[model samples]
Target: MGASLLPFQVVDYFKPGIFPLMFLTGPLLYLYVGSLTIEDFQLKPIHLLHLIPFMLVAIHRSTIQVVPISSSPDLVENPQYLFNKVYYTLLIISAFSYWFLGLQLIIKHRKKMPLYFSNYTGKNSLNWLIFVLSLFLIVFLASFFSFFVNNILGLAPVSYTTLPLNLTVFTFIMVYFGINQSAIYSREKVHSKLRHQQLSPEESLPKSGGALLSDEQIAALSALVKNYLTDKKPYRNPDYNLQMMADDLAISRHKLSHVINSGQKKNFYKFINQFRVEEAKAMLADPSFNHYSVLGIATECGFNAKTSFNRIFKEETGLTPTEFKQTLERSTN
Candidate 1:
């Protein structure tokens, strides 16, 4: 809609009645630029450094319009030509950023492989990185060549005229593929961390392997936690702390912490909330609870607010309450 309404023609971009529409680009620019800046904080220095030129190009596009000189036979004015030249230059620079980062990632990953199976690098990180780098290069070439051919022949006066600047189809496709590749690498990183998690392998044994608790002790602690969840008791009591659970379990705070951390593989608060989330999930799936809002279900589960409840629920089940309920309905149907 916006592309048709605001064509690549410089006159249409800055039309008499279109100033308001053009002005609306300010907030939109702020959104993209602000998000990119925030992302720079989380990204590696090399990745963020590469993205700087792209950010600058986005800013320039957001600010300036390259109008053609009508009276000149060549349709070249000094200022307009300079703007077009700089615009394409910035775009090419930004493409180089992606190319460099992609190559660096590939090289770094390749160096990490074992020499014996280096031939299998094709099945590992190198293959994934190369595929992503190739995809981005294709997008970069397509956009740059498309813009170059259109502008050099005067088919499109503005640098953005050949390709829809606001839409950034190539950038979007490149980012989508990059993120997919990153996700695979990030999961590998997580699994690698998890593999070497414990300092003492002996202590990593399951509670079931040894009598960490007498049957009586286990039953008492389980009953207390179960009742607290079933009763929907608020955790807001000023004195409600780990000490309270320890006292109830008739164990020292240190021992109880070990039991929760080592046995259950979670902190006391998280262990407790896992039970609450289970309660909430049952309620959400029950047809009887269908009339209740999400907030009501969250409160019934002893959560302080719907926000926290929904976040944790999604983390646990990979689905929101609404999504889970929809799945339940679909399965039953």
Candidate 2:
């Protein structure tokens, strides 16, 4: 009885231009379901929050049609009022979830790049945030807010007002798609950056020599490297070479070179590369870092070129960067 009594306009609601697009929503289910399934296998959140829109769209369309019909010929007496309430509550929950997810993604990326920030201070960051926020607002806010405002405060409801509700939903869809496109673009950028880091030699090299370090020297060198890597301030005006490193360590160049050569059993290039490679390795260990390419990792690690990174990595670790990555993945899995 309930199925028959359900407003028949459900089918008519999707007409002509809108029907095809509405039909595509089914396939979109694949994307969300597939991603969630993979996340499950990895012991990650299923992110059902993102999938709520599909359910909400169905609810919105049905409610829009049924509420009017319930007043007319097809009046099923005492039709569950709680049905719409439940659907609306779910929509609100999903909207909040998406907002938090969006903010989390932006925050994570900003921390990765010193130049990247989340606040409104910089034009770029502000613009990006605004664009993203606009997407959410258009997609999930306006229509819902309008509904509440009309019901509570005598403001006009989008569903009944001059505004076309479908148009609002379409605008939201476009904004959502834009966010997806931007995410893809950002992923590519991070990939390139990681590849560049992998090839940089200075990142891989140790301060002097040996795998082990004295507590005091380790503390100082760690601080120096951390500051250097994080701040990225200018290199000094001098040679900017081994002599500089030796001077920084407050040791003679000969002693520094000897320690690097004999103790670490590596030349300057290889030693520096060790630091770079290790750092790259740490970054790669993170699932979020998967967007970065091997080439980007090389450059970020202080390798001047792909060729050098590969050669030195193989010589020092007895495995190529790709091989190392594969090995790491396998072990972790």
lDDT of each: 0.50, 0.46
- Which pairs in model 1 have colliding backbones? none
Over 181-207, each residue of candidate 1 has an lDDT whose tens digit, in order, gives 322122111111112222332233234
> Model 2, residue 175: displacement in angstroms?
5.3
Q: Which ranges of candidate 2 are over 4 A from the true structure?
A: 1-8, 12-81, 115-126, 138-142, 149-333
TM-scores across all candidates? 0.34, 0.35
All models, RMSD in angstroms: 15.9, 18.5
Candidate 2, residues 23-96: lDDT per residue as tens digits? 23323333432332221222235644444456555555554533431122211442542344444445455555
Q: Over the full model, what C-alpha lDDT does candidate 1 score relative to the true structure?
A: 0.50
Ten-residue region with minimum lDDT total, candidate 1: 186-195
Clashes of 1: 0
